[model samples]
Structures are given as C-alpha cells and as structure tokens.
Target: MALNIVIMAAGKGTRMKSTAPKVLHKLAGRSLLAHVLGTAEQLQAQRTVVIVGHGAELVEASAPGPGRQFVRQEPQLGTGHAVQHLNGDVPLIRAATARALIEACGGERLALLTIALPDPTGYGRILRQGQRVLGIVEHKDATPEQHALREVYTGMMAAPTAWLKRAVARLKNDNAQREYYLTDIVAMAAADGVPVVASQATDETEVLGVNSPAQLAELERRVQRAQADTLMEAGVRLADPARFDVRGELICGSDVEIDVGCVFEGRVSVGSNVRIGAYCVIANASIADGAVIHPFTHIDGEKLGVQIGAGALIGPFARLRPGAQLGDEVHIGNFVEVKNSTLAKGAKANHLAYLGDATVGERVNYGAGSITANYDGANKHRTVIGNDVHVGSNCVLVAPITLGDGATIGGGSTLAKDAPAAACEDEEALSTTSAARHRSSHARALSCGLRSR
Candidate 1:
C-alpha cells in the first residue's frame, strides 16, 4: 500500500509565548518537527507533507533536508483545518506505533491512535459502545460525564486515502470552537459504516504533545533519562542519570564512567576504561582507552574533530578546539587551550598555556603561561617543537619558528627565529626595577620640556 504521511505543524503555539514556531523549538538538540519527520522517514512513506504557517518561511528554511514538501496554512486555524488540504503534534510517535495504526486501518477502516491517561483534560474523549468505537467528543464540547473519561483520542489516525479525502471535505466548522474538528471525522466514519477502530498506544510518553515550555522541559528530561538508562544497561556508568545529557550519537565501550552534569553532543565515541569527570562538554570527538577528561573541560570539534589518545589526562579547566590531537600519556592541565595542534606522546602542557597551530614533539614540556603566537594580522602560522625540547615559563614562541631536538628556551623569552639542536636560547636584556624605569621616564619628560603632572 502506498503510504502518505501528513504532519500538522502550523500552530502559533500562543501558550508557548515565543516568536519561533512551536515545531521549531528544540527538545533534544533537534526540533520537534524533526523528530516526527524522522519517524515518518522510517515508515518509507511515499510522500511526507508538512503543514507550515506560523513562522512559515523560517520553518521551511530551517527544515532538515529535501524530499519533504511544505504547504502553508495562512491565518492558522485548528488542527483539522491545518491538515485539511493534506496530521498530529506528537514528536515521540514511534515507527512501530504508526505501523500498528496503519495495520489496524487495513486499507478499509478508520484507525485512530488512542491512549488512556490519568489526566485526560483538554483532550478528545473516545466515545465507545462496548469494544466498538462510535466517535470522539472534544473536551470543550463534551458533557460532564464525558469529561471524566480517561481514554482520549491522541489525534493520530490512519485511514484509506480515498475515504479520508472525502471525510475531510465534508467536515464542517459548526463545533463549539467554530473550527473544523478532525475528530468529527470519527462520527462521519461511523455514520458511513466505515468501521472506526481504535489502536491504543502502550506508552503515554510516545503520544504526548508539547504545547508550552514546561511541557517541552518535561519531555526533554524524559527523553534524556531514557537515553541514560540505555547507556547504563550497556555497561556504561553514569554518576547521576538525571544530570547527564546526550544530544547526539554517543557510543561508549565497556567500563566507561561519566560523572554528573556532562553533556555529549554531536558524535562522540569513548573507548573502554575512559573516565569523564563532572561538568564536561564534549562534541564531535573521540576519546581512546584509559583517557581521563577532568571536570569543567570543554571540547568542541565542529568540522575537524578532536582526538584524545590512550592514557591522556586533560584538564579541570581545559579547552580542546577543532583539530586538536593528543598522543598517549599527554597531559593538558588546568586552564590550557589547544587548537589545531598535535602533541606527541608524553607531551605535557601543564597549566595556563595556549597551543594553537603548533606541532609539539615527544616528551616536550610546554611551560606555564607560554603560547604559540600562531596568528599575525593576515594569516596563521605553525610552531614546531622537536623531541626533548624544554620551553620555560612565560615564553612565547612566535610562529614560523622551530625548536630543534633537546633545545632549551629560557623563561620570559620571545623567540621569532628557529633554534638549532642542543642549544639554550635566552633573552639577553638586563632586568630593570619598576621604580627606576618610572623615574627615568619622568626625567626624560622634563628634559624634553614636557611638565610632569
């Protein structure tokens, strides 16, 4: 059977009180509509049509990709009107649930997805006679007895395309809200002897819809908790499941332990025996076996990913930007930043340093407060440090320079030229006291006929 999926997403979401379209609001690093479309894609639907109206241009532009068509619904009406020309707002609708709905329809019947909720307020009550579903009554139009019914229509249904087209065309706007009700098609199906059937969703979360910020937040936690549970079941240890979040794909090997308040974004792979401390944010990176990522570290490899080698130790306050590659046993200590740099095995940049556009050799000790001045005004350059090089504290290695094997740079030195192997380079300027320099400057001003204040 040819399947066509229509998603109704034209609501203004006035309750959300935001200018962005309701479907555009993100739940787990992806828009709600994206989640629905992903599920639809799994169905192998022949056509997927998205109804857009509120922030139509923005929504259409921000859509994930091609293959899906968009139809505008100006002056956004009710859910029925939104999908009249072609749907529900359930972001977590699983492919299995949709398949069940389609199976219940069987190309002849009207299959409505329904759920039994503890609090079914604001939902359409499923009117039934024994096991047969008669129709659905909206919350605003139902009687007091109907309001007490816990079983409610979930606004998702599957019907024969021919019958659905005919039913929607006959739908009238004479209800309590003066809007065309998609649920009214239930009564039409019943009257036309189309055998209206109900397919109950087992999981309430799978059918829940987002209408406000609080609802979105609630769903976000639920989705994150589910992901956390899956990771834990796979032998990954999470300090606090509620405090962890994975916005994208996270693949973890055995014995991986992640602490509280950590966020893993994009695609991250953690090898076995990896320990990630609390409050770390990692994205688009790979951590090899036995790596230790300390707390408060931030790593984001946007296009060019970062790689942490085995037994590497990274910061309590370190940052690894795009193109950072650390070799085994490397130590990047507190407040250090590495960007587009490669540090060989046993390289240590401990505390308050920046290594950008640089190649650090094996056993090289990049001193505290040192930085590779890789960027001039126009272009960026690279600094090369050979094996066993020792850089003193507060030194600046200006780019387009190199430190040969076993070379030692003195503290407070700024070197622009390359140093040969086994050489000790140091700045030869005599140190001057601050008071003497101040007095000398004042005297020079007086000699130049400029009065001192």
Candidate 2:
C-alpha cells in the first residue's frame, strides 16, 4: 500500500491582505505548506501533492522536488471540494482522515495537535458519537446543541487510507453556508462505527492558522523557539532564546555559544568552540572552530557563501558580503567590509576599511581606513599581495595590481599601480611606543620585535 499526502494550501489568503497566497507566506524560511510537507516527508509519504490556487505557479515551483506533486484549484472551493479534486492523484486515502484510525492502527504514542479557546467561534465542531467520530458540524449551520460542542476540527488527521477516501466522498453542502464540508467526514466515520483518537495541545499557537501578516509573525516566533529548543538539546548555549531568529538554516556543533539578539538567516553552520556575540546577523556563511564573532557584526554571504577559518576574529560592526573568505587567524575589526576577497592567515585589517576582489597573502598587514578599489563603477578587478607584504594606513590599493613579497607601502597612498619599497619602510618610527603606529605601517613585520625591544 503506497502512502500519499495531500496539502490543502489553495486559499487566497484574503485575511492576509497581501497579494501572496496564504501558504506561500514564509515560516522558518519556508512556506507554511512546505512545513506540513516536511512533516509528511518525515512520515515518508510515497507521494506528496500540494493543492495550489493562488500563486499557483510559484507554489508549484516551491515543492516539486522528488516525491512531491502539485494540484491546482481555481476559484477556491471548500475543504471537501479541495479533497475531491485530488481523486485522480491519491487512491483510497482513508488513512488521511480521522484520529480514531491512527490510535487503533498507527503508533502507540500517536497524538493530535489541537487547542480549545474561550471563544470557539467561527469554527467547525468536532462531533463524536461515544468514542467514535460521528462527523463535524459547521458554525454557520450548527444547531444550538451542536454549537455548544467546543472541540473544533484542526483540518489535520492521520487514518487508514481506505476510510479517508470513503469519508471524503460523503461530505455534504446542503446547509446554511452552502459550502462543502470535510468536517462531515468525522461524523460519517463515527456513525459507521469507526473509532478515532485525538490529543489536544496546551498552546493555541500550535493550531492557529496564518491568514495575515500578524498571524504569520506569531507563527514564525513559535517555529523559531521550536528550532532553538532543538539546538539547546544538542548542547548549544543560547543566551536568550526569545531574542534569537533563524530564517534559513543553522547547523551548530557541540559547545557552541550564541549570545542574545543574534539573527541567522540563509544557510549557516557554526563549528565547536565558536562564539557569536550579541546583535550579530550572519547569513549564508560557515564559521570554523575557535572563531569569535564580536557584537553587532553583519555578514551576508548572499549568493556566494562566506567562510571564516579557525581562530578568526571578526568585528563588532564588520560587514562580510558575498565571496568573502578569511583564513586562519585573520583579524577583521570594527567597521571593516570585505567582498569577494580572501584574507590569508595572520592578515589583519583592524579598523575601518574595505577589501574587495583582493587576494591577501600570509602575514599581510592591511592598513586601517584602507581599501582595495577593485571596481571601476563598471567592471570588477583583482588586487594581489604576496606573503609578508605590509600595507600602510589609509592607502587605497587599486585593482589589477600586485605587491610582491616583502614589499612595503607608504601611508595615505592611493596606488592605482603596484610598486615595492624596503620592507621596513617605517622601522625607525615603529620603535615608538604606539602599537597602533607599528600596525599601521609597512614595517608591520617589526611590530612584535619592537614590542619586545
């Protein structure tokens, strides 16, 4: 028996007040329907079909991967009608129907995700004849007695496939609302002597449907908390779970430390012993072990994912854009920006600066307030600096240039072409007490020696 899953996501989302389809609105970097489909995937469904109406093309593209299919519903009809539309796609889907079947047939710890509210208004009531579901009655047509029934239909169930097919066919639209009701299947199953089991969730957030931006925001928070719990279980220390947000993916290794107010979007992986400070936004990036990202740093890997090597230290306010790769022990400090650049081991750009489309070699000391002008506001170019080279403060190294090994640059020089000077161009001045001066000169290699002497 092949298992098939159908996701009802064809709603126009009139309540959402947006042009986007209801389920197309994202939750945890994926559509709400995608979340449901992901859960279905967990169940290992042989076939997963998404019902698309509004933004049909976009929805179809979102989940057309292996084992996933799409069905379109024009002029969106009722829930029962939506199920009927999938007749050709899923055969004998009774297992997708009611809770009773799951309790008797599925796993032992099987449970339902539902919640009751003080105002159980505008919802379909879950009707049970004894321990079995008789069917469901809608709010618009429910009698005074039926209206008193508080248990509402969650539009979610898992049952024997044979029963689900039969129940769906019996839905009726001969009521006040004149809308086909899937809730009728519940009563139909119960009357036919089918037993269904159900469990209730304590929080209403679990069952709340998103029909608007406000609702979407609330659901996003809940989903993020769920993700946070998973990380904490894996031994990751999160300072404040509520303040953390992950829009894409976050894969954390053991003993990772994340401070409060960090936002991780796109795809990000953090290695062990990594420390992400407060208010950091990292996207589409990978940070190796022993790396420390200071507070308020923003890294957007975008199309080209950024990679920070082991022992690297990024700024409290640095921006690492697409294609930025920092090697071991690379230090990028406050207010610096790197794009399409690779900083070799021990390279340090410790103040306000920019490095673009550049290749910096080992032990290269990039100066403060400096930049590699790799763009002509039209075409991009590259700048190459060899090992042990030293760049001076406030110097602009224009692209298509190369600074050979031991080459020294002068302070405040806007170099459109490459040249070399004595490696210790400023060794005399470096002997001064100011470490900043040593770090900002071509004699950067003498920094440690100057300190010792």
Candidate 3:
C-alpha cells in the first residue's frame, strides 16, 4: 500500500512566545518536525508533504533533506485547513505506533491513534460506543463528562487516501472556534457507515505535544531519562540517571560507568570497562577499553573525531579538540589541551600544557607549562618530538621545530630551531650572585636619591 504523510507546521505558537516556529523548537537536539519526518521516513512513505505558514521560509529551508514538498498555509484557518491539507506538532510519535495505526486502518477504515493520559486537558476526547469509536470532540467544545474521559486523540491517524480526501472536503466550520476541525472527520466517517477504529499508543510520552518552554523542557527530561534507562539496562552504570544526558547516539561496551552531570553527544563510542567521570562533556569521540576520563573534561570532535587509546588516563580538567589521537597508556592531565595532535604510546602531558598540530612520540614526557607554538599570525605549523624525548617545564618549542630521539629540553627554554638526537638544550642566561646584585641595586637606588636631593 502506498502511504503519504502530511505534516502540519503552520501554527504561530503564541503560547511559546518565541520568534521561531513551534515545530522548529528542538527537543533532545532535534526539531519537532525533524522527529515527525524521521518517523515518516521509517514508514517508507511515497510522499511527505509539509504545510508551512508562520515561518514558512525558515521552516522550508530547515527541512531535513530533499524529496519533501512544502505547501504554504497562508492566513491559517485551522487544523483541517492546514492539513486540507498534516501532524508536525506531535514530535514523540514512534514509527511502530504509526505502523500499527496503518495496520489498524486495514486500507478500508479510519484508524486514529489514541492514548489514555492522566491529564488529557488540551487533547480531543475520544468518543466511543463500546467497541466502535464514534467521534472525537475538541477540549473546548467537549462537555464536562467528555472532558473527564482519559482516552484522547493523539492527532495522528491513518486512513484510505480517497476516503480521507472525501471526508475532509465535507468538513464544515460551524463549531465554537469557527475553524474546520480535523477531528470532525471522525463523526462523518461514523455517519457514512465507515468503521472508525482506535489504535492506542504504547505510552503517554509517545504522544505528548510541545506548546510552551515548560513542555519542551519536560519532553527533554523525559527523553534523557529514557536514554539513561536504556543504557542502564545495557549494563552501563550511571551515577545519577537524571543528571546524565545523551543528545546523540551513544554506543557503550560492557561495564561502562558514567558519572553524574556527564553529557555525551554526536555519536560517541565507549569501549568495555571505560569510566567517564562527572561533569564531562564528550562529543563525536571514541574512548577505548579501560580508559578513564576524569571529571570536568571536555572533548569535542566537531568533524575530525578524537580517539582516546586503551588504558589512557585523561584529565580532572582537560580538553581534547578535533583531530587529537592518543595512543595506549597516554596520560593527559589537568589543564592540558591537545588539538590536531597524535601522541604515541606512553606519552604523558601531566599539567598545564598545549600540544596543537604536533606529533609526539612514544615514552615522551611533555612537561608542565610546556607548549608547542604551532600557530603564527599567518600560518600554522607542526612540532614533531622523537621517541623518549623530554620537554621541560615552561618551555616553548616553536614550530616548525623537531626534538630528535632521546633529546632533553631544559626548563624555561624557548627554542625556535630543531634540536639534535641525544642532546640536552637549555636557554643560556647571565649568572650573578644574589647578594652582589642586591648591593648593586641598593647603591643605584641611593645614588638616584642623592642626585634628586
């Protein structure tokens, strides 16, 4: 059977009190319309049409990809006219629920997705006569008794395309709101002797709609909790499920432990026995087996991803930017930052250092307060450190410079040129006795005072 999806996204969302379109508002890092489209894609629908109005241009431009057509609903009349058309508002609708609704339709009847909510205040009430579903009454138009009914329409339905067009054409705007209600088709279908079936949703959260900032926030929390639950069920230990968030796909191996206030985004993969500490934000990165990411670490691999090796120990406070690749047993300590660099096995940058656009060799110890000056005003360069090299504290190895095998750079040295293998390089300084220097400074100060007098 050929399935066509119509998404209504024309509402101005005055309740939201924002400039962006309501459907453009995001939940769990994706827009409401995006969620709907994702489900629609799952159905392999023949055509996906989006009816746009409020921010029509913006919405159309932001539409995920090609193959989706957009139609304008200028001076929007109501749900019926917009869709005359659509279900873009309900972002949480799952593909399975939609598939079930289609199956319930059986290509001959009207199948409306319904759910029983504890608070069905704003939704349309589902009117039923025993096994047969009669119609749906909007909350504003429904009577007191109808309002008390917990079963409500989920604003999602599957029907024969021909029957739906005929039913929509017969819809009249004689109701309280003077807008053509899409739910009115239910009563028409019942009158026409067409079987109106109800397909109950899996849960209330699956059909909840967002209309305000509070609702969006609530949905976000619900989504995060669901992700957390799934991770826990998969044997991942979360210190506080409520405090953790996964904005994108997170694939974890066995025995992974995530602490409170950790956020994983953009397709992160953690290996077995890995531990992520509290308040760490990791995106588009992969942490290998037995790696420990300490608290307050920030790793963001925007395009070129970061790779943390097996058994590596990273930061209580550190950052790993795009293109950072650390080998096995590497240690990146507090306040260290690595970008576009590759550190070989056993390399250790223990404190307050920066390694950008550099290649660090095996067993190298990058000392505290040391940095590779890889960027100049005009261009960027690379620093290469050979095997077993030691970069001393407070030293700067300006690119394009190389420290050869077994090289040792002394503390406080600022080297612009390359250093040869098995050599120790230090910045030369004029030595003076502290007492003599102090006496010379005192005599100069006395002479200056006498001259002034």
Candidate 4:
C-alpha cells in the first residue's frame, strides 16, 4: 500500500518569539520538520503534503524533497481553518479527497500517529465510547471527567482517504476561541461508523510541538538521548551519554570508545577499534581503523572533510581542519595543528607544529615547533617534504618549497627556498653537536653544537 503523510504546520508559534518557523527549529542537527519528514519517509509514505505558513517558503524547504509537496495556508488561520486551505494545492486531503488518495495509495491499512501525555492541557482530549472513539473535546470545552483523562490526540491522523475527506468537510469553527479545530473530524468519523485506528508511541517528545525556547531545549535533550542510545547499543563505549552531543551523523564501527565531553558535529565515521579521548570535538571527518584521537582534539572537516588513516595517533591538543589527510601511523602530537595538509605514512609531527597547506612524505620526522609557513599576507602557498626527511626544531620551511629525499633541516633554520634535509644529519651532528644518536627517531634533546674556539 502506498502511504501518504500530511504534515500540518501553519501555526505562528507566538510563544517562540522568533522570526523562524517553529518546525524549522532544530533538535538533533536537523530541523524539526526535517525529522518529521524523515520518520514519515521511513514508514514508506509515498507522498508527503506539508501545510506551510508564516515563512511558508522556509518551512517548505526544510521538509524532505522529491516525493514531498507543499500547500500554503494564507491569512494565518486556526488549525481546522489552516487545514481547510488544502484547496487545489494538495492532490489529496480536500473535501471528498480521501477516496482519491486511497485510490492513489493502494489503500490496505491506515494508522494515526499519536501520543498519550501526562498533562493534557491545551490539547483536545480523546472521547472513547467503549472500544470505539466517539469524538475529540477541546481542552476549553472538556468536562471535568474528560479533563482528567490523560489520553489526548496529537493533530496527526491517517484513515481511508474517502472518510478523511468527509471528516474535513463536516468540520466546524463554532467555539469560544472562534477557531476551527481539526479534532472535530473524530466525531464525524465515529458518527459515520467508519473504523478509525490510532498508533501510539510513548515518550511524548516525538509528538511535542515546539512553541517556545524551553520546549525546544527539552526536545533537543530527548533527541540527543535517542542518538546516544543508538551508538551505545552499537558497542561504542561512551563515558557519559548525557554529556555527549552529536550534532551530525556519526557512523561507528565495532568497539569504538568515546570518552566524556566529546561532541561529534557533522558527518563523522569512526572505524573499528578507534579510541576518541575526552573533550574531543570532531566534525565532518573520517577516522580509519585502530586510530587513537587523544584528549582535547578539535577536528572540523567543514565542506572538504579531514581523514585520519589507520593506526594514527592524534592530539592531546590537536586541531585538524578542512582538507587534512593523514596516512597510516601518522603522529600528530600535542599543540599540533594541520590544515589543508597531508601527512604521509609513519610521519611524525610530535609536538607544537603547524603544517598548513602542505604535503609531507613517508617516514618524515616533522620536528617539534616546526612549521610550514604556507601563508604570507597576500596569498597562501604549499610546502612539500620528500621521503625520509628530518626537520629540526624551530625550523620554518617557507611556502611553495620542497625538500629532497633523506634531507635534514637544521635547528633554528628558516628555509625560505627549496633545499635538502641534509643540513642537520646524524653524520653532521657528530661534528656539530658531538651527541650520540639515540635509539628513538624523534628529537628528545636539543644538541646545541659549538665550534672548539
């Protein structure tokens, strides 16, 4: 059967006190309208009709595209009146339109999405006669017994398209508020002897309408909890799910461990056996298998995302910006920042360095405090380091330059032009610093070599 979704979203939401439409307000990195459309699509809704008003264009754009269509509700009417604006805009849902919709959707089953809230104030209360629904009583007109009933109707429904069409036709606005209430359709449906079925989901957050900043915040927490729970169920260890915030989509592999104070912003993927340390903020990035992102790493991939290769070690205060691509076993240590740069396999930028707009070669040892001066006042440039290069501390390799293979850059050397890394090799270090080369590859101690004056 072809399922169709009708989203009623024409309210001004005066309590929100903002210019933007209430449905446009976001909960989990996506607009509330987007969330509704997504859920409806998941239910295999063949067509979605969004009733738009109050920045109608913005609301229409926020809803899902392709199969979705929009209808305008002008003059800012009440719920029933807003729906009445269906007019010629919607192919379905007009007076006597339900039968046409049923023919289009291959009618087999119908269900209304609703919730049962604890406090049923300001909503229409459901009136049930035995096992059948009688009608809906608005909160203002509900009797004391009806007021005590917690079961309320969220203004979302599904039925045989024909019956729905008739219900809308019979709706009235003769009330104290003088606003037409869509809930009146329930009485019509019950009176017509049409069988109406309702589907209820617990956790009122899904059906909560955002009319204020406070409600928006509450919904945000609910949405985040759902995402966090999904991640935890996927074997990703989170220190505190409540403390974590995923603003964008996060895809994680097996055994991924994320510590407290972590925020994954945009589209991010974590490979198997990955460990994201505390206070790390990652966005629009992909981390390969077995990678360890240490504490306080802030990675924002933006339009052009950052990619960290397998078995890489990053952070303790690392910032990987857009266009950063790290090869296997790359080490980006404390106070290191890489922007629009590529670090080759086994390369190490172990501490206090900036490699912006640069290309680094395999097994290159990027020294502490070493930087690629890729930006001048006028324009940005690139620096290239060839294979097996050793860059010394406090060395600044200016932009639009390249170092040859097995090259050595001297400590305190500022190379404005292309050169070899042979300036500070271990062979030269014997005569220069008179210090033995240690077992480790990276510089552990500064060899301030002097001449026997």
Candidate 5:
C-alpha cells in the first residue's frame, strides 16, 4: 500500500503575534514546517501534501519542492474539515508529530501517537480497552470523568486511506465547539470493526506542538540539548552541553573537543583531534585534523567556504570570511581578518592584519598591522607574495603588485610597484639590515648564475 503523508500547517498562530504562518516560524534555524518536511522526506511516501490556510501563500512559498502538493483550507474550519479536502485512501496527520506516528503506524493499521501528560488540558483524551484503542474524546466534549484520562491524542494519526475518507465524510459538527473533530474518526473505525492502535512516544518533547512564542523557545532548548547529547554519544567532547547550539548540521570526527558557548551553523565539519575554543561561531566551513581554533574566532563561509588545513592555528580573535584557505601549519593570529585569500604552508599572518584577494606563498611572513590593498574603489585586484618573502610591520602592498621570491620588504613601506626577486624595498632605511643586503646580493648572483646557464 502506498503511503500519502498530509502535513496540516494552516494555523495562523495568533498567540505567536506574527504575520507569518505558524508553521513558518523558526526553530533551530529551520521553520517548523521544514522540520516536518524533513521527516516526511525520510518516509519516502507516495505523495506529500501540505494543507495550508493562514498565510497560505507564504507557507506555499517555503515548501515548494518537487514532490510536495498543497491544498488550501479557506476560512480555516477545523481538523476534520482539513482532511475532508483530501482524496480517498491517504494517511492524514498534523505536521508536528509526523515522525513518531509514521514510525508507529507502519501502514498496517490506524495508529494514534499518544502521550501520558500530567495535565492533559486543551487536548483530546484517548479512550482505550485492554491494548485496543476505542476512540478519543475532546476535552470540550469529554465529561469531567473522561478529562482525568492521562493519555492524550497528539494530533497525529495514520489510517487506511479509503476508510479515512469514509470516516471523515461521516463527521458531524455536533461537538461542544461546533467544529468537525478529526478524533471522531477513531470511534467510527472501532464501530466498523477496524483495529485502532496507539503508538506511545517515550519523549513528550518530540511530540510537542508550538502554539506560542513561549512554546517555540521551549522547543529550541529541547532541540539543542538533543543535538548536544548526540554529539557526546559519538565521542565528541563538549565542555558544557547546555551551552552549545547547533542551528544547522555539525559533523565531528574522532576526538573533537568543543568548548562552551560555541555556535555552529550551516553545515560545518570538524576533523579528527580538532579543538574549538570558547564562544566561536563557525558556519559552512571545514576544519581539518589537529587544527586549533582559539576563542572568539568567527568564521562565516556564507556561500564560498573557508578551509583550515591540518595542524593550522587560528585566532584568539580572528575572522575568516568566505574563500579564505590556509595550508598546513599556517598561523592566523589575534584580531586578523582573511578574505578570499590563500596562505600556503608555514605562512604566518600575526596580529591586526588583513589579507584580502591575496595569494601568499610558502614560509611568507605577513607582519602586524599590514594589509593587502586589494580594492582600488572601482575594482578589486590581487597581491602575490612569492616563496620566502618577508613583509615587514605596518606595510601595505597595493594590488596588482608582486613581491618576488627571497625579497625583503621593510617596515612602513607602501609599495605600489613590483619588487624584484631577492631585492629589498623600503620607503625609508632600505640599507639598514645586513640580512636584507645579503638577500639582495644573493638574488643578483643567482640571477647572473641563471643567465650564464
């Protein structure tokens, strides 16, 4: 039998006090409807239909994937009326608890996902008889005696497609609320000699329905705690589980240690033995093995990601923007920012520097307070530092310039022209350092030797 999953997301969420549809409100960086859709995708149903009413256009815009179909419930009747808009022989349920119900039903019988709540107010009570679910009574319709029942319906169920259609058609708006109740179908199923079952969820949090701002906040903390537990179970050490937040997927390899107050977003992957210090925000980046990301490092690889190579050390307070790539053993020190740049092996950009649209060669020393003047107002250009180039303090290398291999750039120099291989360029005091002089002589000798060859 093919399974059709119906996600009821038409509520206006008046308690949330927002113009957005209730389902469109975010929890853990994804809309509640998105989370339900993700679980629905896992079921691989024959068709996934979304019932939209309040802010229907906005809700439709969010989940407009290839396999999704939408039906509008204009004037927003009730749950029974919602399902009445569907065709025959499909399992219909609310989106909030879709996963537990789908897993429990197995498409074999009519199953209601129920929980034993301490106070089951404002919910329908599940009626049962010796392992068989008889029906459910709404709190408004239930007598004071029935209201004492602990097991309550979670607004989630699965039934035989044809039987459900017949049952819903027979529904009447005779209840206290004067609304056609979907729970009425439970009694109908039992009367027709159909087996009604209940799937009990162990965690009430998983079946929680968000109806207000307070509920949304409660759900967020629950989700974060679950994510923290999952990572710890997989051998990733978290300093304080309650302090970690993962708004998107976080993949951690063996022996990864993340400190408190770290927030990961948008598909970050941490390699084996990587240590992330406190209060770091990393998004859409890859941290290679043995790399250490010190405290307060912010890496946001929005679309084009940042990559940290093996054994690299970055930040007590550094920012790595999109397209920043560092090779093995590279060091990016405090208050430095790198954007759209590549630093090769053993390169060090230490303290209050910026590298933008630049390519740095192996063993290049980028000094403190130095910057690559890659933007010239109208356009952006590139700066290339060849192997073994030493860039001194407070220097600015204008874009479309190159510092040749074995060359030395003196402190406070703002060089707009290219510096030749093995030469020394300084705005002032170019003849001071013996090491710079020796490099200039050796570069000249090497050039002559190469010409003779």
Candidate 6:
C-alpha cells in the first residue's frame, strides 16, 4: 500500500496566547513542527502534506524545505474537519505524535495510538473488549462509567486510505459542541466488522504537545535531557546536566569534561581529555586533546573556525573570534582576546592582551596589557613576532611591523618599525633607567640602555 502522511496543524492554540502558531514555537532550538517533520522524514512516505490554519503564511514561510505540500483549513472547525480537509488519505494527528502512530500502524487494521494516563480527564477513553479495541469515547460524550477508563486515545490514528475516507464521510456533528469528532471513526470501524487496534507509546514524552508557554518550557527540558543522556552515554562528564544547553551539534571524544552553565552551538567538536569550564559559549570550534578552556571563555567560529591545539590552555575570561588558531602548548590568559591570529608552540600571552591579525612564533612571551595594533582606520595589517621574542608589559606593536628573533621590547613602548634580532628597544629616552636589556642566544648580554640602530 502507498503510504501518505498527513499532519493536522490547523488549530489556533488559543491556550498558548501568542500571535505565532503553536506548531512554530521552538522546542530544543527547532520549531515544534520541524521536530515532527524530522520524524516524518524517517518514514520516507510516498507523499507528505501539512494542513495549516492560523498563521498559515508564517508557518509556510518558515517551513524547512521545498518537498512538503500544504493545505489550508480556514475558520478551523475541529480535529475531524481538519483531517477531512486533506480528503482522508493517510494517517492523521498532530505532528508531535506522528512517528509512534506510523510505526504502530500495520496498515491492515484501524490503529489508534493510546496512552495510559493517571488523570484521563477531558481525553477520549479507549473502549476495549477482551484484547480487541472497540472504540474511543470522548469524555464529553462518554457515559459516567466509561469516563473512568485510564487508557485514552492520543488523537493519532492510521487506517486503510479508502476506509478512512468512507468512515469520515459518514461522520456527523451531533456531539454537544456540534463539532465533527475524529474519534467517532473507531466505533464506525468496529461496527463495520473491521478490526480496531491500539498501540501504547513506550515513552509518553514523545507524544507531548506544546499548547502553552509552560508546556513549551517543560518540553525543552525533556529534549535537553535526551541530548544530555546521549553525551553521558558516550563518556562525556557534565558537571550539571540541567545547566547545559546544546542548540546545535556537539561532538565529543572520551574523557571530556564540561562544567556548569555551558552553551554549545553550531557544530563544536571536543577531543579526548579536554576540559571546558563553567559558563562558556563555544560555537563551531575544534578543541584538541588535553586542551583546557577555563571559565567564561567565548569562542565563536563564525564563517572562519577557531582551533585550539593539544595541551593548549585558554582563559578564565578570554574571547577567541574567527580565525584564531593556537599551536600545541600555547597559553592565552585571562582577559585576552585573539582574532584572526595564530600562536605557535610554547607562545604565551598571559593577561589583558589583544592579538589580532598577527602571527606569534615559538617561545614568545607576550606580557600583560599588550596588543597587536593590526587595524589602522581604513585597512588592516599584520604583526609578526619571531622566535624567543620577549614583549614587555603594556606595549603596543603597531602592525605592518615585525620583531625579529631574540628581540626585547621595553615596558610601555609602542613600535611602528621592526625591531632587529637580539636588540633592545626602550621607550624611556630621557630617564636612562637601563631601559631594556636583552641576552643573545649565545648567552652574551647586550650593553644596557642602547639606542635603536
């Protein structure tokens, strides 16, 4: 039999008290309807149709892609009428519960996905004889005795497409609300000598619908729990699972530890033995093995991604923007911001520094309050620090410049031109305070207070 999937999304969701359609509300960073569509995609049905009503234009515009077909239900009547708008071919339900109904459907019998709830108030009671399902009686129409039944219909059903159309055609709006009831088909099927079946959902959370803000929040937590469980099962240690939020994909290796209040977005990957501290927001970055990202660090790899090498240590409050790359054993301390820069092995920028559009070489010690002045009004430039360079506190290396190997820049100095290898450049010209000193790679000390050549 050709399978067709119909999603009934025509209701205005007055209980939600919002202008946006309830199905378009977010659950786990995706619209609720999108979540339903994702499950439907797994079925690979012959045809998929979404019935839209309130906020139809917005819902259709925000919908994920091109293949889905849509029909509108103007001045929505009821659930039965919503399904009828599709002309009755395929299964019917809120998008949230489609997967269970589709999976439970054997396609030969009329199937309803039912749940056993402690409080079955306002729900349609599932009537059964022996092991066979008889019908579903809505609480408003059910007798006092039938109202006590715990198993209730979940507004989801599957049946032969032809039979479904015929049964719906015979439906009447004779109920108290004068609304067409889809549940009426269960009794119609049983009366016609057709077998009616009920399938119980394994996890009740999967069928939860978001009709209000409170309900949406609860659903978000449920989704977060699932994401956390998957990570935990893979050996990732989370300090507090409740405090973690993953808006996008997060790939983790073994022995990875994440602290409280972390939000990961846009496809981040953490390698083995990595530790991410509290309140960090990391997005689209790759953190290598043995890397430790301290508390409050922000790494956003927008367009151009950021990479942290093995054994690299970053932050207690640092920002790494696009194109920041750190080689093995590099250290970026508190309050440092790195953007479009690459720090080679053993490089250290210990505090209050900004290294943008720069290349830092091995064993370079960049002091506190130092910065690479890489942008000059209209154009951007680069600063290069060669091997074994020692940049003093509060100095600024103006871009389009370089500090050769074994160079020493004095405290509070700003350099526009390149500093020669093994040279000492001091800012204090008047106060001969032995301004700056440098020892050559051969261990020979240069004369103190020397002027620039």
Q: What is the clash count for each candidate, in the order shown?
A: 0, 16, 0, 7, 3, 0
Q: What is the lDDT for 429 in model 3?
A: 17
Number of clashes found in candidate 6? 0
* Candidate 6 lDDT for residue 243: 92
Q: Tens-digit lDDT track for model 4 on 317-429?
A: 99999999999999999999999999899999989999999999999888888788887899999999988888878777778888887777766566676775544433223
lDDT of candidate 2? 0.73
RMSD of each: 6.8, 7.1, 7.1, 7.4, 6.6, 6.1
The lDDT of each candidate is 0.86, 0.73, 0.87, 0.74, 0.82, 0.80
Error of 6 at 78 (Å): 2.9
Q: Cα lDDT for residue 306, model 2?
A: 100
339-424: candidate 5 lDDT, tens digit per residue: 99999999998888999999999998888988998998999999999998888788878888888997888766677889898877
lDDT of 2 by residue, 32-51 (tens): 76666655655565787777
- Please tell me which model should have the higher TM-score, number 3 or number 6: 3
After superposition, candidate 5 runs with Cα above 4 Å error: 84-109, 129-132, 174-178, 191-193, 428-453
Candidate 5 global lDDT? 0.82
Global local distance difference test of model 6: 0.80
How far residue 223's Cα lies from its native spot in candidate 1, in Å, is 0.8
Task: Looking at model 4, report the run of 10 residues with the lowest lDDT sum.
Answer: 85-94
lDDT of 3 by residue, 365-447 (tens): 88899899888899999999999888778887889998899887767667787888976666531122211222354544332
What's model 1's lDDT at 262? 99
The candidate with the higher TM-score, 2 or 3, is 3
Q: Candidate 2 at 148: error in angstroms? A: 4.6
